[model samples]
Target: MIPEESRFESDPEELVELPPTLPDGWEIATPDAGDRFTVARLTHLLRAHESAGRGWAGAGVDDVLLEVSEASLRTRENVVVRDPEGEIQAWGSVHDRAGGRMLFVHVVARDLDERLGRACSDVLVEWAVGQARAVGAARGLETQQIDTGAFADDERQHRWLAAQGFTMVRTWWQMSRPVAPEESELVPDPAEWDGRDVTFRLVRRTGDGMPEEQDLREVHEVLESAFTDHFNSHEETFEEFLHRLRLEPGHRWHHWWLAELTDGPEPQPVGALIGEVSPSSNGPDSSYVSYIGVLESARGRGVAKGLLHTIIADAAARGRDSVGLEVDADSPTGASELYLGLGWETRYVTQSWHRDVPVVEAD
Candidate 1:
């Protein structure tokens, strides 16, 4: 509950009213840098509760805090709801991605009565869509799209998104596999590369572990080309791609790897795999595959398999507990089959929803 005197005072245009389902004392305010810890705690609690029936893992406090910090810097709008005692009950934000052509909204709320939950989500969704429209107008674009996701088992979230005019666009599999202590044998030996003149190596870094510019550029090039035909693929600038990945917690230069083929006139960069360490809710640290791609020309040459083996072996060497990744369930490349063969199993599924916003022209 927000105090009477400390209740947020904002321009009438910016002030979003609490839904009638909520208590009269509830207040809405924009969070600042100082609210990182509180926001993270609230996010973790809400996600944990929501994930119970979905079988997906909730994010750790460190990762949530990093996300909050980055959102405060990069997003177009962010807001939070507080109870009468001033405890954060819900948080939401809208990120304008791909230069305002796409808006991604994230809303998390603590467990409450169904009516209150729906009311809280409604306010956030309305505010997020309004922000998206403003961003589209500023960019002079005719229209923009709003995107959000919900776990397959979370019917309440699905209903809220449907009521907001978002349609389910795609489904994804969240998969994970345990890292064995002696998995080095699982990695293919160098001699096994008989017919395919391919090699896998970690991205070169300086003494301080900063990636070399050339290798980093090659990584971006490979991913851009490989994902050209992928589902919902978009053209992201090299700077945006790198900056987004670097903002994640436990992102390290050493976690990036590349696969090259010497059979070409010159060494050809065929595949790239980037990983980050995540604190698991169960106990030990886990390795997450953030991005993995192989060029179309290199698909049949086992480049993708090599990159996966390299990451798995590295995680085993570092004593990480497991490796996790998400894959497009409808991918034409049959990526899920590859993970299945390597012992990865589906933990849960999530659906992506999209809504298009009409742009407002200036008078």
Candidate 2:
């Protein structure tokens, strides 16, 4: 149990409270019933409060909002907390990704009082678990940032999760590279690699409306070929990827790039780089490389480096301050080494905790 004493005497707003029962005026709702307003409120709460601000510190408000929106659209179960005035104070949602169900809890706002914090979390978890059981979900998951430095509260948070029966399973590193202000260094001069015949272009449908079937087919082939040997080499369908990306608030179509094999039978895309920028927190100031992959046939021909350079130059040209991405610490592709060689630095690390859960029996 969290200590009864308030952690912050200077600010009464900082106290966290856990309750034996729900507070008098709070109500809960499902996403289908106009829950986005609640999500927006909790998002603001998390953004404004320092303690709940770390995981998405570098992300823009618009980006996070889009994430929540996407999740709301996909998940069958979502728990929202609203004050008596019908204003959302906190929320947590579940993502039914791949074969497992992930409980994505975004602690949007917290009171200075510890009791209030505990109360909010207690309700959120209880609701999430109940929803999982109702949906025949076997497992629950959450992502919490682990601090590499002494000043962070990751230890306490981890201990709390363990107390709730979760354990650490895998880890990831937050890496970043500074974008130099001078365009002379990062951009590739056409003269330097002129004869290589290698070129990168953003993929798009020929028409202006909904994505054409051909465009999606290409996205599927490119992503599948790119991550054939990647660390978490699980197959996520094109529809899933499309839905997920479109759900992101800051998702921009042009940020996705494809390297076409100029000599190939189909002018096929052999490598791809996907990126996004936040308009809320990163303040429309920085771009983040969300994912990148190079097809097996395209691996050794400077495709990866060329794609990275292209993305970096694009972000810089767009006036981004820094570029960020995550690399598996144990990736066999030596991706971390490549990023390091290009000047990206490690900020810290985070672990992925997972446990095999027994499937719920069908009635």
Candidate 3:
């Protein structure tokens, strides 16, 4: 329950307070739109430095730019650490998700002396948690959980997070599938399960390319119902859900699809898939499944499979190099198996760490 008017102040001068204990010649600065390229490059460097044999597929500048642009909405604060020479060396951000109930804190840095690395991480995380508390107070929330993640094999990050009071809570598999030439030859037909009266179709869109209001609502409803039982599920308003996804770099209306059963009195929405084009680290560009879900009543009816196949087919038709998604490794639905069976393979694993922080009114 953040106070309605307690939004994060983004005044750069007020945001760049460096810790007194930071190594001499190191400073902190709030990033702006102009820092996109530099931040992207620094991020790539940090990923490569920390990635343990798991190749880091770094985000593109546009991806970073979109994140920065969306910060006003979701981010409590973000900062970059630089050396005396002004070379960006590290970055951190705290994201307020689900309206300040959950905060995601991320910290990354280039390989540095053990002491300096630890100090820098400590300062950023401390500032991030402080901001998270302010966000919760503004929302009128009494408490919130601070969440963060690290590559499973990155011991340095894992150790740092542990020292910051986080505990490993979940693991995720980042998976990707290369688009096959033959995939384009596959018929673009709705999937049907044996003896199941189920069907799928591209969501109807207006001439302006926006999905019809009814279809959009159905998409949200289907996903909400489908993921109700999922890990860390939380109810977000339809407006929040839609706007959050649209804030990403490649969100487009045509990338949405729905699965419905026509065997009933009328078409009933049972599943939905939303996708976006993304800049790939391995190839030209890729399609990413941002959200895919099937209603509890529609499980095992090929509805989820149908939506996935349709997405792959669409990606192939557009000559995208690959399709990528992240799945909860502990998903009760065993979704990883389905993706693996469909040619997707795990590229890397990341672990989610969480810490419950007490919320108090902002001073």
Candidate 4:
């Protein structure tokens, strides 16, 4: 991943390190290259937190690295806290996500004392609150939205966010579907298949090995249009959309797919699916559908199913263990029902917590 320091552009409010918000005898500052222990512990904190909250841990080593990498620093700020004894106690990262939404990853040491844990959570959240205002002010937004998520079963996390004025806004089912090797032939070659006048194929690429600009734009437009009426929909520029997706850990160009109605006047793009290569430590890697959208106008025309079928077939052909995707449980289009019919099962549940804070404008 390449780093671009120009992205955040915090100017005067560039997140001054260690603002003395943490308590005495606790070291709080942004992570640096010299602190390998701090980085390793942060990854442990995430895995341990997920394991305890849900039934399993899915964030792999690479996934954790991307969270704290230099490239990530372009749009994210991270802080790590260590005790006077030099033991890392907590770590947090705040991402200046699209529009006015800021994503906070609040991870505290699972084995710390209950009192210390609360203190650490408070420190992390306070820092995030400040960062949110800085980003909102930079973007000239009146209301900054703090978006954080936690496993549905984690009562502790719920309490922490609730106490911080965040309300549970949505529930998501993280679903997975196993792909048998024989399922590779499930679809007759995505490139050549035109099912019901809707064609399913990978996003076109040029000789430069980069996705075609027109195709990329179409995919972006399809998703933006698809989710326009959904919950908490926000307008994200094409550049912002492309930049964020490229920062994903397992991001790849080949994983992107688009569906278009071939019989239409000039073949209109109606559906899109952006996938990620999920590397597993023990087995074949999986294919994760990071973003999948079918236009509301084309919903009943089997566009969504065609895209799903193409991904399943592609995963099987690639020898992946499974295909994973997240679906909003309260989707207006009954999306969860579609996945349920396609051999997917819910492995875990997550909830989105949001708090809206006014932009902390410069005095």
Task: List lDDT for all candidates, in order.
Answer: 0.73, 0.57, 0.73, 0.83
lDDT of 4 by residue, 152-233 (tens): 9999899888998999999999999999998889899855478998888888889988889999999999999999998888
> How do the residues 1-363 of candidate 2 rate in per-residue lDDT, one tens digit apiece?
111321112111222232455568766654333355554565566555434424444333553455454343444334556667776666665554433334345353555255555566566555544444433333232322111111133554454445555556556777888776574346464112221556676666566755456655676688777776765455566765676677776688777776777775566567777788745342546677887878886778887888788777877777777788888888878888999999899876766544333334346
Candidate with better lDDT, 3 vs 4? 4
* lDDT against true structure, model 3: 0.73
Ranking by lDDT: 4, 1, 3, 2
Whole-model lDDT, model 1: 0.73
- lDDT for 260 (candidate 3): 80
Per-residue lDDT for 94-189 in model 1, tens only?
655555445554555546677877777777776766676666666567877787778888787788889978999999999999999788556653
For each candidate in turn, the TM-score is: 0.87, 0.73, 0.87, 0.93
Full-model lDDT, candidate 2: 0.57
Please state the error at residue 125 of candidate 3 in Å. Answer: 0.8
TM-score of 3: 0.87
Worst 10 residues of 1 by lDDT: 1-10
